[model samples]
Target: MTLRWLLTGRVQGVGFRPFVYRLAREHGIHGWVRNRSGQVEILGQGRTDRLDRFERALTDAAPPTAAPHIAEREVLAWQQLEDFRIETSQAGDRPWIQVPPDHFACPDCLAEVRDPTDRRYRYPFNNCTQCGPRYTLIRALPYDRPNTTLSGFVMCPACATEYRDPGDRRFHAEPIACPDCGPWLSYRPDTAPAPAAEGEAAVEAAAAALRAGEILAVKGIGGYHLMCAADNTDAIERLRARKPRPHKPLAVLFPDEVSLLRREVNCSEAELACLRSAQRPILLLPRTPAPSLPESLAPGLGELGVMLPCSPLHALLLQAAGGPLVATSGNLSGEPVLTDNAEADARLSDVVDGFLHHNRPIQRPADDSVLRPIAGAVRPLRLGRGSAPLELELETGVPEPLLAVGAHMKNTLALAWDRRLIVSPHIGDMGSRRSLEVFRQLVEDFQALHGVRATRLLCDAHPDYTTHRWARESGLPVTPVFHHHAHASALCGEHGIDEPCLIFTWDGTGYGADGGLWGGEALYGRPGHWRHLARLRPFRLPGGDRAGREPWRAAAALCWENGLDYTPPVTEPSLLRAAWQRGLNSPATSAAGRLFDAAASLIGLLQTASYEGQGPMLLEQAAAGCAGEALVLPLLTEAPPWQLDWTPLLAHLRDGRLPVAQRAADFHASLAGAIRDTARRTAADHAFTRVGLTGGVFQNRLLTELAQSRLQAAGFEVLLCRQLPCNDAGISAGQVYEHLGGQRGED
Candidate 1:
């Protein structure tokens, strides 16, 4: 019997072809295996039983990191072939395969790197087929070395021998190279007249600088990272000053030692597993009560964003530095991470004391992926590095190629064609010209890489957003997706909830269907046919977008709306009140995020936020370990579109006698109760039992857990984002999913 199969889902760059070749030989099959487009195609000529076993093993015994599925199978005419062999990859037209995210160094590769006698000993670029650069280095499809940035480095004799050996781990490894032929590292200190160092000497000098409390811009698998000793307050303060990032938490890369990691942060088994996973994303874990690490790493927050070394270069540097290092993205505030070496040297020279870069050029930038253990799962917050080019299977097919330009903040782009959806990594906030340029380039690069020119585009409904404007000017048919609707749709799509459901799409701000700013919204029904059933009672945001930075504005607005006589901390409160009364520069919003800020400010937690989500973070922190009864938040259900009134809740938050922590805890409880009541009312009316919690506000662990617990206790099937984020980073995927759900009469 003869059979042909097309396997997809991470079939390329993960030793899939070699594994298939070995399986064919083991089963006494005589044919060939090759990569076509982004998939693996195999032809087998063998006994029927043997072929069946081979097909079963194709998925069952595939590479540990590969998620292979037989996308196509067919009985073929008998072929005369002597032995199974690997064939050259074919760059076919329709690429429908998952681009493998960059992987952490496998244990075997790490062992070889650490071994003193091994050829790749202390080699910063050591990687095998099962581990290493995949998406970050690849320049085009078929994932062959010639299509990657690594094509410049010719393999040495030993490496070539391993590459040709089908039984070897390095077989067909696209980025395979050794010290004799691989890319080398170079370090240039900031001080003039100091000569640059190369190879091991460069690594040593960079490590020495880090130990001496100097920040170094070190290149990694994805992009450049500004790294410094975690314990060095001077270095941390210097980086903060240079980057001008005052309070946004910095991620720290710890040595690959669990014991050392546990000394500073409390890690559960799942968090530890996530930290050591092949993806090696930065995991937000709780800090020890008395952490030895400096507080400046994550000031005022009880948790720290920590990650294990994801690449050999980082592993070697950690070993050399002898401690954890603060490894933040190499960029100025509100800009994309730097990928080009010359650009990094030019833009980040003022931020770092030296440059530790290599000759291997990065095709694009992928910042570090971030995950937080929330509501009993490690949910993705920022999809990047080892977690992006996130591909998802669609429940329904998208007939035409579609591009979804995500929201302005925490931006990401998505491309959907056939039954697959590919979401780009977190493209930083589109607030700067450089960031917008990167966003535009990423849109083109994604389309080019997939060989799919999108016939239609999806973007946020807001006319002023950079993504929306870009989409409007792209000359493609544009479909405007409401921001909150996209968030709700993304959550439902990820969970595969096709039934009518009630979703609470809460965030800081989003352009609403009714032209008002929405954040606390209860959207009923499924994607493409949702109805705005309920919302938080409207409150005016004085100074519009500026209210996001000034928590006092939200507090004053809440106080004024509730008719409370609380004095605000602002110098010109009367002017703000007059603006609100006259409706000048005051946009009425129902955003749950602003309510959190209002509560935090009312309790005297934060008056002005240095970074986005600072007030909410402090509020969540204050609520930690405290349990308060749910305050009364009346559900006004007299009308078709109900309202969640916060009149009673505000009075409790304004009580000066109550502990701030208790007030914070009660605020969260009241919101959760409001969610439960609203879900119950909506479900009772519509007979929909499933509920979804989505949007950036749901990224708050405390609120998500509380709401999820309440909804589940009320006997509702709750859906939360698992593979994708609940934040705007997942908006592109949501936009694609919303379009695929059905036509909504727009576009």
Candidate 2:
């Protein structure tokens, strides 16, 4: 009997063909395996029992990175063959197959690099079938070496022999190379060319420069990263000055697990597993008491963004440095990470002290992905580098192909087709022309790679956002989804919820249907069909958008509403009162984020925000150890649009007798009470027992914990963001969900 099989999923670049060949040979079957149009295809002729065993083995024992499922199977005419052979890859018109994500260096490869007796001793690019770069080096589909950045390099005789031998581990590894035929490393100073060193010498030079308090722009698998000693405050300060980033925390490359533990970092089993996963993203782990690391590294944050080295090159550099090093994106603030060598030399020369250059070319720049352990799942915050080109399978399918253009901040794009939603990596805020162009390119690249011709586009209702504008002008059928609705729908879709639930969507700002700004929202229903049930009392935002930059304006607005006298000495209280009264530049908003900013400013913790969500983050910090009781607030539960009145809470916060720390802690507790009370009343009235917490404010661990505890105690099943982020990065996924639901007439 002869059989033909077509397989799909991540089966192209992950050594699936070689695994099949070996399995077939082990079964003594006559067959052939090859890649065709982003999938694996097989034709076999053998005894029925042997073929059945071969099929079982193929299903049970595939490559680590591949999850292949049979797309088609056909009984073929018998053409008895002698032995199994791996054939050449066949190209097609469209590459719709899943592209491989970057992988962490496997243990076997790592051991070979550090072992003196191994042929690839200390080799930075030593990789076999189990591990290596895949997405970053790949240029097109049918993932062969000629289609990657290593197309120009010819393999040596020894490596070629290993590639053809089915018994060898490097049988079909596309990135298989050695020192004689692989890319070499070199160290070049800013003003002078250092000695052209290869292998261990170049890595040592880079490490020495880092140890001596100099910043080195080192190229890795995805892109370049700026490296400096973590303990050297001078080097960190210099890097901060050069990059000009004021307060955002930088990720650190820990030398080993022991080094991270010495700094008083606690890693739970889930966090540890995420750190050691194939997609080695930076894990946000909580800090322990009496921490040894300098406070300047993270400034007011409680958790540290840390990661072990993912590549052999990174491992070698960290091993030589003997300590942790601050590893930040290579480019300056607000620009994309630098990938090209000449571009790095031209654009990053003024910022970096030296360059640890390599010959491998990066097809695109991908920032390191970040994950946080929350609600028992390692949630993705910034989906890039090792965990990008994300394919999420939806419970239902869409009628037509669609693209979801995400929000203005933490932007990402999604393409939905055939029950699969493909999300792009985290694109930076669309504030500059460069970032906007990059967003456009990402949309185009994803479409080209996945063979998606989007017939419809979905965007946020906010008119001024760059993402919304781009989608509207794309000459496709555009649908505008409300920001809070998008958030609620994304959570519902991620959990595959088809029933009504109470959703609390709280964040900084979103365009509301009432011609005002909305953030603190309570909705009832399922995806694509939700009704706004309640909101926090609306307050005027003095000076409109400027109030977001200055937290004191929000404080003044709240004080003016409560008939208070003080305004924290920011731009005169009378002027802000006039703006609020006349409705000149003031716009009314019901944003819970503004409430946090108001509370923070009232307690004198943050008057001006250095970054987005800075005030609320600092407020959480100040509330760390206080055990004060929560102050009760009034709740208006009579009408359909219930009000969470902040008047009584604000009055108590303005009291002179309370300590600032106690007030901050009380404010957090008070807000938690308000959410709990609102959920209780709304859930009882609507008879809904499930609640989903979404939006950017859910990133706060304290608030999330408080809300989850209170809601669960009230006998409600709580759903928090487990896969994607709670921020705007996950908005595209929500948009796609809503659109798909609308297609099925469920809206």
Candidate 3:
């Protein structure tokens, strides 16, 4: 008898080969196991009964992460003469395998780290085939040690022995290492070895302070994070005060299942399942009035971002604290998440009690990814950790190699090669010198490694943006990609939906094709083809950039633009009146995000935003309780490109008398409703089935759900972005979509 098997998806790097070797030897089956580029394949020959047992064990008792498929057909047995000898990893000649996302800690490795008797006991960097780092540490493909950050560390004799042993837990585990040989921890300032007693003590003290109502900044695998007990009202308030993160919901880390139920409110069985999944994202569950926690943890938000223990050290701290902790990106408001320990130590010194950190270097700064199990299964709210540096499926026919320079904010660069879209890790706003350097590095690295030559460059139409400026100077033919088009195209790529649908691109700032700041938009669009169909009624952005910080300026502008009776009260709302009375504000701007900001301000909620999208985010939070339509945004035929005018809609906001929450809800409902009606009309005219929604505004859960529901109800199979973000972080993907879906064809 003879047998063979095929493996796929993250099967490489994990110790599948050794397990197969041992299982084959034990069952007295003769076989050879080796890796193919993207998969593992095995061939075995033995007696029927023994092969059957071997096959069962391969699937049942294999490494927890190894997923294998067996194939058997009649073939002559290559009868074994003696014991099984380990085979070398073979090259996988085939080309279609995707590089897997870095794996989170596995249970077995965690068990060993916790077990005092285990050789890897207390090993902070403990990893095996079943689990460890993946996307964060990997630098190149074919997943060999030489291609990863681990390339520098050579395995010790003990680790090497286990690495090659058929019976050892780490056999064939590429990142396999013990404390003796793997990466070690050290402190930065001292440079001398900081023993656990001396080094980790400060971390313990910080945790203690957190438990006692103090915030601490802790450095993790990817970047720095601000931590404090979620249950401690003082700690939450302190973190908020220090960071100035007032309204946006802070992400919390739960110890286990018990704490998950205890804190967050609406936990459906599906959400719980996803929470426990290996992805380990910050799950968005409904908020609960929990005992022991402060309501201010999530501010005005209806739901919270929560995650279970991802690292062994995180587990220990949570256990010591005895509850959930507020874990948010460690950065001062607009800047990127800090990856350098020194930066965190210097900047967050006063903000936190002390730094709970180690010396293991972070190659890139990736933020904590947020996710929600909406419309079935899990979808990414923010694509990071376990999900970034994504490679898109490209059409191989593109005539020229193009570099899609993403937006100026939440920047990510895309290099398209022979239909493969290689996206860089999230680069923060490129306006800063540091972010600009990172962007340049990403372009160079991708071009060098992927062997892509820049024949043409594409960028946002924004002239002043660093991305656009760089693309212009790149000496490549530059095509200016419109902001809303890229936004819509990103959602189109996610679902591969190619036809025209209604696109609602509402964000803080985007250069409209009409030579104005266009955030509020409703367009009939596809990946490559989009026509401006409608937009929010135009108004001058009061104080220009100041409108973002103070939503009230736009709030007052909304009142003053259309005919309204008395001036707003001269109290807290007076700021808007003053901005209006003074000629400091603009009178002709059309931005959807500003509309949201204004709405939030109108309710006396988020008068000022601590961060980007903060005002609108709080508005969504406040509107959670307010559903059902209270007002309808009227459609008027006013401008070219846009078939409908928003002037009538502003008229309603000026006169409608509804409660703040109800007004907010009606605003969202009408926007989605209008989009649905417009999309129906657009699709009928365009004669297409696919409807794709993208952009920052689509990040709104309420708006997303409403638009999806209405579109489906209208006999359209609507596609929503799940894998990539609808926000600017995903704009690079959209840019590639435009490049690929462009008339030149091919990726």
Candidate 4:
């Protein structure tokens, strides 16, 4: 019997062809396997029983990193063949394969690097078929070595032998290389007085500089990382001063040893598994109390962003440093992560004491991915590095190709055609010219790589957003999706929730359907068709966008609105009050995020936020381990569109008699109760049992867990973001979902 099979899904760059070759040989089958555009094709001839086993094992015993499924299978006339072979890849029309994200150094490869007798001992570029760069190196589809950035490096005889051996782990590994034939590393000191170094000595010198409390810009798998010893307060302070990032938390890269990682942060079994997974994303775990590591690493926060070394280079650096290192992105403030060596030197020369350079070129920049364990599951906060090019199948197909340019902050673009959706990695906030350029380039790159040309574009309704403006100027028809609606839709689309559901989208800011700024919203129904069911009672934000930076402005707004006499810590309070009364620069907002900011300020947790979401983070930190009763937040349901009044909670937040921690905890409880109450009333009226919590505010673990538990206890099926983020990073995906054929609600 002869059979042909077509396999799709993460089949390329994951040793799928080699695995099939071995499987066919074991089954005594005569066949050939080759990679096609976006898929794998296999032909086999064997006895009926043997063929059955082969077919079953094709998916069951495939490579660990491959998620293969037979897309098509057919029986053909028998043909005699001597043996199975791996054939060359071909480019087919309509390429639509899942681009494999960069994988962390596999255990086998790591073992090889650590083995003293091995040829690849201490080789920073050691990689096997099962692990290494894929998306960041690939220039086109049909993922062959010639299509990658590593094509310039010729394999040595020993490496070439291993590459052709089916039994070898390095078989067909595109990025396979050694010290003799692969890219070499060099270290250059910023000051001419210090000596330069090469190879292992380069790593040593970099480590020595880090130990001496000097910052070093070290190149890694996807881009350069600005690194320094985590325990060195002076180094951290120097990095902070040079980077000009005062309060935003920095991610620390620990040695591969989990034991060492556990000393700094409290890790659960699930978090440990995620840390050691092939993706190796930075997991936000609770920090150990009284940790020896500097408090400046994550000041005023209960959690730390920690990651295991994702590459051999990172592992070597961590091992040489003899301690944890702050491995933050190599870029200027408000810019995308730097990828070019020349650009890094030109921009960051003054910021670092030395440079650890490598000849291995990165085709693109993929910053480290970030995730957190929430509500019994690990959820992505920023999808990058090992979690990008996220592909999803739509429940309903679209007729034409389209692109979604995500919101201003946490920008990520999405391309969709037929039933497939491909979301780009996290593009930094579109606040700077460099970031906007990256966003535009990413959109073009995604369309080109996927071989799909978008005829239409989806953008947020806010006309002032850079993405929205770019979409309008792109000469393609544009669909303006409401900001909060996109947040709700992203949640609905991710969970395949087509049924009428209520989604609470709480974020910092999104342009509302009614032209007001919305952050706290209860949207009913599904994608495409959504009804504004309820909202947080509107309040004015003095100083417009400046209120987001200064929590005191939000607090003052709450005080003035609620007729409270408490004074806000800001200059010219009387003038600000007059502006509030006259409605000069203040904009009306129902944003739940601003409510948190106000609560944080009123409780004296934070008066000014150095970074976005800082106030809420400090509030959450203060509320940890404290239990408080939910204050009464009236549910005003007299009208069609109801309101959850936050007025009653303001006084409690201002009460000095209550402990600040208790107030913070009570604020979270009260908001959760309000969400539950609003959901109950909406469900009672509409007979919808499913409720979703989405938007940037849902990134708050305590609030999301509390809201989820309350809703679930009230007999509602709760839906939360599991794969994609609940923040604006997910807005692009939701925009694509809106056009995927859904019942249209009232405009």
Candidate 5:
């Protein structure tokens, strides 16, 4: 008897063919197996028992990350079979395709890189089928050598031999290259060390600059990174002073074990695993500060984000330069990450002391992903690293492929095909022309690479948002997803839940569908759909965004919301009075962010924020230990669409019975209670059970933890955003999810 089989699911890049060959040989099958598109097809002539054993072994004993192997069996017509072997195929195109993303360097490649005797030793571009470059270098799909950067440099005979051998790790590894054949590295700085040639000499000059306490633009696998020694106090301070990042934690990249001792912190098994993953994200670790590090790197922050070297260049630089280095994103705050070399040179001339950067084209820009451990698995704070290119797999699917332009701030676009969602790297605010270009390019790159043709687009409900503006100009069918609802919706879709769940979202600002600014809010709903259950009461955003920079205006707005008067609310001589002149500049907003700024000023927190979210973080730290007082919170709405009015809470602050910490704690409790009560009322009316929480506000540990507890206690299942961020960084996923789901009028 003869048989044919088709196997699918994560079959590419993974060692599917080699494993299959071994299984077929053991079972005495006579035919061939080969990959066509993403599916692997097999033709074998053998007894039914042998065929079954071969199939079972292939599926069950697959490699580490191999997903379930889906197979189809067919009774073949009479055919004479030769020896069973793996072969190549040309029919790789499928009308409906789900392409897998590129992956990290595999173990075999790593061994070759470290082995001094190996031809590829110390090759920065060393990669094989289980690892290395994917989408960034790919110009097209089916992802073969002819279609990649490897096309420029043909593989050496020795390497080509392994690539052609299905039994070897390099088999079909499209990116395989030896040092003699692959891309070369050359150094270019303003002042070059004497005789800057190729290889080790170029690396030595770059190391010299680092050891001298100078900032250098060092290029690597993904893109350029602004590097400076972590332990050099003066150098670290210089970077901080120039960058103007007063309190946000700087991500540290350790080159070797010797330097790990300098920044190593109190970490659990989960934390360690996250740091060591292929994505190699900056893991937030708690420690008593590195003795070698100065206080300037992260002023007044509780933790630091750290990682180890995953690239050969970074390793060599560190080995030469000597110790821990600050590997911050190569961009100014509120701007897109530096991608082009010319762009980096033009913008970073003053910030960087010198250049250790080389010329290796970065096809797609990706920032280092950030993660933190919550339950056993790591919760991605910012999903980048080895996680982009591939789409975020969904549980509840959409009807058509959709393109979602995420929030205006921390901009990232989402491209969805079927249930697969691919989110772009963090693109900063879309207000700038440069950032917008990066955003648009990211969208085009993802669609072209994945063959995802979007039929509809999803945009935030906020009409005035930059992202919304782009969506309108996109010339594609778009669905307007309310800012807060999208936040919760993304969370629901990420964690794989269907029913209504309590969603607690607290962020700086979002345009509520009610024509108000919303930040601090709690709601009960599911992914694609949500109801406005409760929110912070209306307050003025004095001078609009001007108030965000100067928190005193927000503090004054808090008093105004409570029916009080304060022309100057604060004692700062620099206070701009026109900002508080009612309609002269002020606009009423229900933004939770305004509330944080207001509370921070009231509780005597940081006078002003150098960057976004700085003031709020300080306020939360001060309000941490206090067991806050209970306050009378009125309903913004009488019933049904029950809203917890901020009037009573403001009056409590006015009464002055509670200290600032107690008042903040009480404010959180009031917000939690309001969400809990309203969700119960809505659940009773609609008979809904699942609730999803999304928004930058949920990033507040205290607020989310408390809100989930209160709602869970009330018999309402609460779903918190995990796979995606609660912040605007993860907004694209929600926008894509909704547009894909029939939420959009047109496909």
Candidate 6:
């Protein structure tokens, strides 16, 4: 009998073809296995029983890395052949197969690095088919060594032997290399005779630099990372100063599980599993009562971003140092992570003590992904490194390939082809030159890698956005989607819900249809046809852009709207008051985030924000200890943009006798109540049954849970973000969904 099989789902660059070849040889079948786009194609001829067993084993007992193996088999003409073998990969113009993202170092590679007797002992670039860089190294299709960064390093005779041997773990590994033939590391600022070192010596030198309370720029799988001992206050403070990032938490890479446990970082089984998984992202875990790290590391935040070593080099560095190290993106503030060695030396020379760079080139730069456990599931904050180029199966198809250029902040790109949506890794903010360059490269690379040309480009409606300008200039047909609408579309697309749903989109700011900044919108409809049903009442943002930096400005705006004669604690409050009164540079905005900031500032919990969401974070922290019913607030029904007036809530907050903690909790409850009331009223008016909560404001766990429970009690199915974030980072996905979900076409 003859059989032809097509296998999909993480089959490429994951040792699937080699596994198939081994299985064929074991069964004495004559067949060949090769990668076709994102899938594995196999043709085998043998006894009927043997073919059946091969089919069963292919799906059941494939390699550990070849996951979600979906197989389809067809009977074919029996072809007589002497032996089974692996065939050359067939390239296509469209991305129809799944490309496995970069994975953590496998156990075998780690063992080889730890074993002193092994030839690869302490080797920084030690990797195999089961693990190591895949997405970051691959420059083009076929996923062969010639198409990857490893093309520069020819394999040694011993490594060649392992590559050819199907039974070996490194069989057909694209990145197979050793100390004698692979890329070597070098120290920057060329001062000493032994500036460049190979194998164990290079690893030790980098580790020694970390031990001496100095920050080192270490080249990692996706990009460069700044490393320093987590316990060293001077090093942490210095790193913060160099980056000019004051309050945002830094991720800590612990040497081992014991070291992590000793720090008393709270972790559930699921979180620990994610930390140890192949996609080793920085897991944001709760901090213990007495956290071991310096307060400056994660000041004002309750959770600590922690991760285990994802690469053999990271493991070796942490092992040699014998302590936790602060691992942050190797870049200045608001810029993309540095991947090029020359760029690192040029940009990070003064910031880092020394550079630990390797000769192996990096095709693209990706930062470490950040994730948090919420309601017993992992949620992505920044999708990069091991979790990027994320593929989401779309229930609907598009007319042609589509590109969705995301928002200005937390920028990411997305591509829609056939019934799949591929969201690119997080590309940071689009404001910086480096970040814009990275975004352009990522878009072009995605096109080339997948062999798909985007005929249509979807962008945020904001006319001033860099991504929007890029789309307009691309020569492709452009579709401008509203910012919050994209957020709603992303969640709807993920759940495969094509029907109209109630979307409560809350965030800081989005370009609204009324020529004003809008957030905290309650819309009712589907992707392409959604219309805003109601929104928070517009209030003047005193000093315009300065309102985000100073929460007191938002407080002043709220106070002015409510006719309160109160002076806010701010620099030149009178100037801000004049701006609000004269409408000079004070833009009217209906934003839930501004409301949170106003409430926080009113209670004196937070007046200034060092980071993007700091005020809301502190407000949530203060509310953590208070337990009470939601305070009553007026839900005014005038028209179009209905008002959820904060007058009653502000009156309660004005009482100085009440504890700030209680006021914070009451404020959260009141806002949640307002959201629930608006959602319920909109759903009843539209006769909708499902409600989707999206946008950055939903990142607040307290508000999410509160709104979700209330909506459920009010008899509506709730759709909350699971795989993708609720922030602007997820806008690309929603954009793609909005672009394609409404269209019906054939490939």
Counting clashing residue pairs in each candidate, in order, gives 0, 0, 17, 1, 23, 1
Model 1 Cα RMSD, 1 decimal: 1.7
lDDT of each: 0.89, 0.84, 0.70, 0.88, 0.70, 0.84
List candidate 5 stretches off by more than 4 Å: 1-3, 26-30, 57-59, 65-73, 84-86, 89-104, 191-197, 244-246, 255-264, 289-292, 374-377, 394-398, 564-581, 623-637, 647-686, 740-747
Estimate the overall C-alpha local distance difference test score of candidate 1. 0.89
lDDT value, residue 741 of candidate 2: 67
lDDT of 4 by residue, 338-385 (tens): 888778888899899889988889887888899988899999999999
**Segments in model 3 whose C-alpha atoms lie over 4 Å from true places:** 1-12, 15-98, 140-142, 151-154, 180-206, 373-377, 395-401, 445-456, 565-587, 638-640, 643-657, 744-747
Error of 1 at 477 (Å): 0.7
Clashes of 1: 0
- Identify the superior model by lDDT, candidate 2 or candidate 4: 4
Return the number of clashes found in candidate 5.
23
Query: Candidate 2 on 663-692: residue-level lDDT in tens?
Result: 877887887778888888886678788898
Candidate 4: stretches off by over 4 Å: 192-195, 566-570, 741-747
Residue 219 CA displacement from its true place in model 5, Å: 1.7
TM-score of each: 0.98, 0.95, 0.85, 0.98, 0.89, 0.96
* Model 1: per-residue Cα lDDT over 598-687, one tens digit each: 988988899999899999999999999999689868889888568999988777887899999999999999899999999887877797
C-alpha RMSD between model 6 and the true structure: 2.3
Q: Model 1: which ten-residue window has the lowest total lDDT?
A: 738-747
Q: Write the per-residue lDDT of candidate 6 for residues 154-201, one digit (tens) a residue.
A: 889999999999899899999998889998887653244446655577
- Predicted structure with the largest lDDT when compared to the true one: 1
- Candidate 1 vs candidate 2: the TM-score winner is 1
Query: Which 10-residue span in candidate 5 carries the lowest summed lDDT?
Result: 738-747
Residue 592 CA displacement from its true place in model 4, Å: 0.6
